[model samples]
Target: MKNILVLCTGNSCRSQMAHGFLNQQLGDQAAIYSAGIETHGLNPGAVATMQRAGLDITSHTSNHVDEYAGIDWDFIITVCDHAYENCPFIPAPNAQRLHHNFYDPSKFEGSEKDTRAAFDKARDEIKAYVTDFASTHF
Candidate 1:
């Protein structure tokens, strides 16, 4: 199976969502993993948002990029500008690096409804992105 890694500033939101979507889209075609430059733990907003979409990410954990140093990744995807710009050099020389700046719903400050909307929007965008990525590359 191909090894795919989704990255973000914190493994809490965008990357987590993408990880869920990738797992669903690629199924047995690839091994999907998500990590961050720094671990912020799993975001509850992300978990709830994904749960609404019928993807349970509650079991996922926030991980530092260094954790997977030994594995050869087939693809490395950054879901936030911060992670993409500040990401350290990964040794997976042959890995295809892809990037998308997804909004951080965890950073949105608003009423509960608006915050939920933000999470939903990010989740949908991530779902669409991973769907396309999986179809094109897997």
Candidate 2:
């Protein structure tokens, strides 16, 4: 099975969401992992957002990219620009590098309704991207 890595600035939001979507879409075709340049713990908003979409990411943890240094990655996808630009060089020689700058819902400061909407928007965008990625790649 192929190994895919989803990366973000902090493993709290976008990368975690993409991990959930990719796992749902790819199934046994690929092994999906998510990490960050720095760990910020799992975001509660992210878990709740994914729950509404029928995907469970509550068991997921915030991991640093170094944790998987020994594995060979088939693809390394960055879900945010900060990660894409600041990520250290991962020694995945054969891995295809992909990037998308998803908005940070965590940065949204507003009412509860607006905050949820922000997370929902980010989740939908990530879902669409990962769905197409699964179809095209796997």
Candidate 3:
């Protein structure tokens, strides 16, 4: 199985969700993992969004990028633009890196409904990207 890594500023939100979705959708074809440039606890909104999509990430933990050093990856996808630009070396020499930026739902500030909607939108965008990527490249 190919190993894929997803990264973001915080392992809390976007990266976590992407990990959950890819693992679910790709099944045995890929082993997906996620980490952050810096550690932050998993965001509750992120957890909620994944649960709504029928993917459970409640057991997922926010992890630092250092945890992945020395591990070989087939692919390393950055789920946020900033993280993409700042990513460090991956052990896999032939690993294909992709920048697939997604809006950070945690940045949304508004009423509860609006916050939920923002999370949903971000979640859907990531899902769409995953679907397209899987169809074309996985």
List, in order, the clash count of every candidate structure.
0, 0, 0
Best candidate, lDDT: 2
Per-residue alpha-carbon lDDT of model 1 for 1-138, expressed as tens digits?
999999999898899999999888889999999999999999999999999999998889899999999899999999999999999999998899999999899999999999999999999999989888977996
Q: What is the C-alpha RMSD of each candidate to the true structure, in Å?
A: 0.7, 0.5, 1.0
Write the candidate numbers in order of decreasing lDDT. Answer: 2, 1, 3
Q: For every model shown, what is its TM-score relative to the native structure?
A: 0.98, 0.99, 0.96
lDDT of 2: 0.95
- Write one digit per residue (lDDT tens) for candidate 2, span 15-125: 999999998998899999999999999999999999999999999999999999889999999999999999999998999999999999999999999999999999999
| Candidate 3 per-residue lDDT over residues 1-138, each given as its tens digit | 988889999899999988988988899999888999988999999999999999999999999898988778888899998888877766788788888889999999999999999999999999988888788777
Off by over 4 Å in 2: none
- Is 1 or 2 the stronger prediction by TM-score? 2
**Model 3 regions lying over 4 Å from their true place:** none
